[model samples]
Target: MSVLKPKIMMLIGCLMTSSAMATEVEPYNKANAQQLKQSIYERTATATSAIERYQLAKSEAWLSYADHEYSEGGFTSAGKEAYIQANQLLEPSNVNLVTQIISPSQVMRRDLWWQIEYLKQRGALDVEPQALANAEVMLVWAAAEYCELGWRHAREHFISAERELQKVIYALPEEKPFLNWSETETPELSALNGKGCHGVNPDLWPLKPKTPVEPEVIDADVANVVVENVVHFAVDRAVLNTEGKRVLEQIANILAEYPDMNITLKGYTDIRASVAYNIALSQRRIDSVRDYLLEKGVNSSRITAEAKGKLEPQDDQKIEMAHAKSRRVVVYFNDAETNSITVQPQWRDLQIER
Candidate 1:
């Protein structure tokens, strides 16, 4: 049997959340495009060196792309972000473009923005404008997605931003700034340089490196495969604990990676209270999990939830400590019923948090 790609044949079509039907950008398209065009011409008229002319051309290209994305639906933020890149790359002589024209209070993507800015001040743009341009666009798009949509949509762009920026950083030498020519280059020690917001908190870092759930593909020809993960909650509590949150985050990551796989969150409660109350509690638990997944950018249309209180308990009744085992939300990743094998996550832990 030929091995198929990890495409979820049964899952919903992965759609861009913020890019399509971005009609709001229509009102500002002409004005924004004109602003960038004027800036480009201003630099073009003064561009005497071959390098300056090249940069100006790139700036114009980005402006054109911005116009195209703006005219298209569901790309309002992208158009704006591209527009920003066009202005930034121009870097007019003696013009404090970043410090004066752009707002220092930009809070999103600050660290990456700072490093990229530092590189621009050195010579990243002159050396490899396309690489630098891709990085800048990705960085701004990442932040814009986070601000407009959420982390689920933003994580992809953030990853791309880092990767593209690394290409530029690796290709270019660590040159000294024109003014601070004697200073050393240390990216790890760099600060936000009076930018309004403090860097992203480590505790709340979205998609920080973690052991990802590797689903095992049992067969190659069975397309009706379902991947499953479980999020265990505390006794009777609907709120998710730290461990539960981590489990759900991993689930969200899977959904992010597999757009075609629809998720079914089935909540189960231990055999303790009345079936009705337990059912309600189980629903609440699933609600908590579903809400977290939604906030992480999982489309609500792709999610289904069920409450199974005490009926389908995972059998924690034998041991005193096993009762908490039944209070869980089994996350099922369903694919289109075809002819592929099933995939399952390797996770089983009773999560208890006070």
Candidate 2:
């Protein structure tokens, strides 16, 4: 019995050594590449519906990265893993993935799952299909890039994903006041702290309401899209701060959504600066805002930005506050179709806040 036990142990050791682990070298070649490329091509070819196409795009992006890896670095294992994940998008019907796409191996994808799930909760997929679709596809691509071969070549995709998601967050149609984002003020752009998808703060994502959004009230104040005291400059400076950029980003999103609603940016400065300085300063200010809007894809024709110099106050009470308020840009929106605004004459003409 002892002799038999030793022989059995020896046989077990031989089996374990033979199947120790996957070979470091890959079985990748031009033939294998063509085979995989063709396989992924077939799995996602018949996508016609919005959801199907959405998933299909993600699969295609993953396949592209996989092909790059195989051709550039001879990485078969990671590429093969990515291919498997990509195919998951097309198979088993993407209707099941409306809330969240399943990624089994790349844990980084899990970091971004909360965002996609929240958007589904808000029901924003249908509201901004192209934007959200682009976001989702880039998100999976980021996950694959970040994880595959420990390569950090996914920063571009991560940034692209964040920008698209930003559009969906602020651009979705809503009857309510946009979780206080639209009615109250523009929230600061989120930062990445090596956590969620691209390190964006999930808590910063707007709190979606229980009821669905109302498209009729997309820009409830369509005639006055920029109704708030949005861009208030500091002392005599015209350069936009972080807060100003945030405000403009939201306005840009609005303008992009409603191209028919023309925007007016009126730049103002404090009483301390000379009239000439204030004029140039205010010009710089509005120019800054205008250039920002243009960079954000707002048509130049849709904007009417001018420097209004300073608005002399009537009293000295809280003079500092008044000066701060004076150094501001008043944003007003008018319907291009009617060439008019619903706001009263005084408000439409920029009532100088005392």
Candidate 3:
């Protein structure tokens, strides 16, 4: 059995999925022939060095061959081989321009993986519907690319692809009228989507843009994911207990190992108090946690503390324990998914003051 190339197959699938009326050449078209040809000339001419110029020339030659092949009929075997060779020699900059300005008009062959790159150039942020759809196309193609590359960095690309796809999904009701795509497609797309790519929280994707920095290393096989400890205070009291100081020490040691990791100290409280009072109490707890961490030499910017009273309880069962758990602050490593976690033996038995 013959295996169809992913790009060619995907294009065919897309065509099959859409109505022929919807397949009109205008809405999907990026640029016209004159514009495309002009871009080719401009890019080729504007190339700064001999190397860049040669690469652009090679890309233009391939575009010419592709146009001829599509419009004027088949090429000779030798001519086809020459076209392939010229394409292989093209640089990434030239390749990007060719795809961005020309690929929409060309016949997508087995080697067609250019459309996704074009869409990546227009990420999902504040883009039009067609552009966002094009980004989704890029995302699907990115999955195929990652499958082909099979590296750790491929995880980043795969996640980015999903993010773009998600934006398209979120905007669908606003974009197309009376059109609802099946949620079943989510499983297929979600398979390759890696966690922690959707920004700081998993719930928000594409909208929240957080840099995925590598966690810092501290001791042997230990990395600091959070630079400070999350401490709980009694009501409005900001005093630190022995156990609280011990937790801070643990956080400090981890920070010493990995001085670059950022920390988020979140405070919570029991539901016994009024909403406003609890909110203020939570805020105070967070501030206290922040101050403690800052005193331990952690940068102020690296530490962000927030208080949410009774809103985020640890568990509903055992109300007292849950309330106690709620009245405490917890530290989170910004990039915990990619980092190794270490638990100091003594820090496991923490008993924060009520």
Q: Which candidate is the best by lDDT?
A: 1
Candidate 1 vs candidate 2: the lDDT winner is: 1
Estimate TM-scores for all models.
Answer: 0.34, 0.39, 0.32
Cα lDDT tens digits for candidate 1, 1-354: 121123421111222112221223323468767976887788678876534654576567557656776777755645665566566556543122121111211235545655655555444645555656556545545555565567897798787766556545534433222222222332222242233322232222221121123347557565453444666767768777665677677767767877787878888887789989999999998898889999999999999988888887553223433465677788876776312425443223354322
Per-candidate Cα lDDT values, in order, are: 0.56, 0.53, 0.44
Best by TM-score: 2
Model 3 quality (TM-score): 0.32
The C-alpha stretches of model 3 lying farther than 4 A from their native spots are 1-230, 336-338, 342-354
Residue pair clashes in candidate 3: 116-138, 218-257, 268-326
Ranking, lDDT, top scorer first? 1, 2, 3
Which model is ahead, 1 or 3, in terms of lDDT? Answer: 1
